[model samples]
Target: MKFRMAKKSDLKEIVRLLADDELGSKREKYEDPLPEAYYNAFSAIENQGGNQILLVIKDEIIIGCLQLTIIPGLARLGIKRAQIEGVRVDQNYRGQKIGEALFREAITIAKSEGCGLVQLTTDKERKDVFRFYEKLGFTSTHEGMKLILN
Candidate 1:
């Protein structure tokens, strides 16, 4: 598998991967006519510094993708940390350690950016993903909560 930074044209494939799963299918729209909001959001991410969308390709096809955002904060002794989001691997490629490779690359990128930590939040419904993360050495040190608006 080849991992690289995602381009604007890769958004469709990325969205497909995001929507392929059970939870994502309900939250993400993978329709014939793609939404303008997706492009708008992609553009926003592209224009932002310290933010990256990564794609994992095999045989010239996109099979996995994730987003990493490096945040500078006053906490952790003024350290910068990388927040990982939207991690997805194609269903056909599951249990092959592709997700592990994605996280390794993210960690490499984060360290290169001088980040001291990498963090992410997964839905409570994703028990398997929780175990996967734990196997990756992530500890459940804090409770994550979110409030949706609109």
Candidate 2:
């Protein structure tokens, strides 16, 4: 497997992975010629200096993806942090260590970017994901809440 920053051409496969799960199926509109909004959002993220969508590929097939953003904060002595989101591993490729490789590469990138911490939030209903994260040394140190405006 190899890691690389996602390109516009890889969006379809990335969306496929994102939409494979029950929770994602409700939110992602993965279709042939995906909605324009996805392209627009991807463009916005691509233009951001500290944000990137990373992808994992094996034998030329995209199988996993995640978004990483470096944030500058003043709370911890102006420490910079890496915020990870949209983590998804292809359903057919689970239990093959892709998830672990993804995180390992992300953390390495975060360290190279001078980030003091790396964090991400997953839905409470994803119990298996919680355990998966714990195995990677992540702890539930804070409570995260969200309010939907849409």
Candidate 3:
């Protein structure tokens, strides 16, 4: 598998991956336009120097995608932190460690970009997934809540 920065052209495949429930359920109204928004958001992020979107390809097919966003702040450590979002691996490719590989690559990218820490949020009900992230070196450090616009 090869990993590279995502381009606008990869939106369709990325959306398909994100649409898969194995990945996670998407936001209601935004679900239909997610592909376009993902591309636009990624473009905006890269342009702003706070985001990096990557795609994992195998056999010329996009198997996974992730967005890493850097948060600049004046905190205890002077290091910028990264937030991982829109992470999804194709259903057919699930058990192959592609997700882990993608995450590892994202972390490498974050570190190279000078981010002090990396973070991501998964649904609390996903117990197995929480374990997986912990195994990959992420800690449960904070609580998160969201009120999606209806």
Candidate 4:
């Protein structure tokens, strides 16, 4: 598998991987022509200095993806942290350790960026994933909250 920063052309495949999940299908709309909002959002991240969408490819097809963002904060003594989000592995490729590989790559990038820590959030209902994350050395030590504004 090859890990690389995603190109605009990979957006649709990445969305396919994301929406293949039970929970993601509720939030992501993966269609023949993906909504302009996805493209617009991709462009925004592509232009940011500390943000990137990473793709895992095998045999010239995208099999997994995740977005990594380096956030510099004053709360942690001005340390930089890596936030991993939107992780997904293609349904056909699950159970093959592709997700694990993606996480490993993200951590490697975080270290190169001088990040002090790496963190990610998953829905509590995703019971199957909690163990996988824990196996990867993650701990459930903090409560995560979110607000929706329209």
Which candidate number maximizes lDDT?
2
Model 3 regions lying over 4 Å from their true place = 22-39
Which residue pairs in candidate 4 collide? none
Q: How do the residues 26-91 of candidate 2 rate in per-residue lDDT, one tens digit apiece?
A: 999999889998999999999999999999999999999999999999988998999999999999
lDDT per residue as tens, model 1, 1-150: 889999989989999999999999999999877899999999999999999899899999999999999999999799998999999999999999999999999989999999998999999999889888988889998999999997
Candidate 3: tens digits of C-alpha lDDT, residues 1-150: 999988777766776777776335454223555645566665786697767678999999999998888888788567788899878888899889999999999999889888889989887666777877898999998999989885
What TM-score would you give candidate 1 relative to the actual structure? Answer: 0.98
TM-score of each: 0.98, 0.98, 0.85, 0.97
lDDT of 4 at 128: 95
Query: Relative to the true structure, how large is the alpha-carbon lDDT of every model?
Result: 0.94, 0.94, 0.80, 0.93
lDDT tens per residue, model 4, 1-150: 999999998888988988998899999999989999999999999899999999999999999999999999997789899999999998899999999999999999999999999999999889999999999999998999999895
Backbone clash pairs for candidate 3 read none
Clashes of each: 0, 0, 0, 0
> Is 2 or 3 the stronger prediction by TM-score?
2
User: lDDT (0-100) at residue 5 of candidate 4?
Assistant: 98
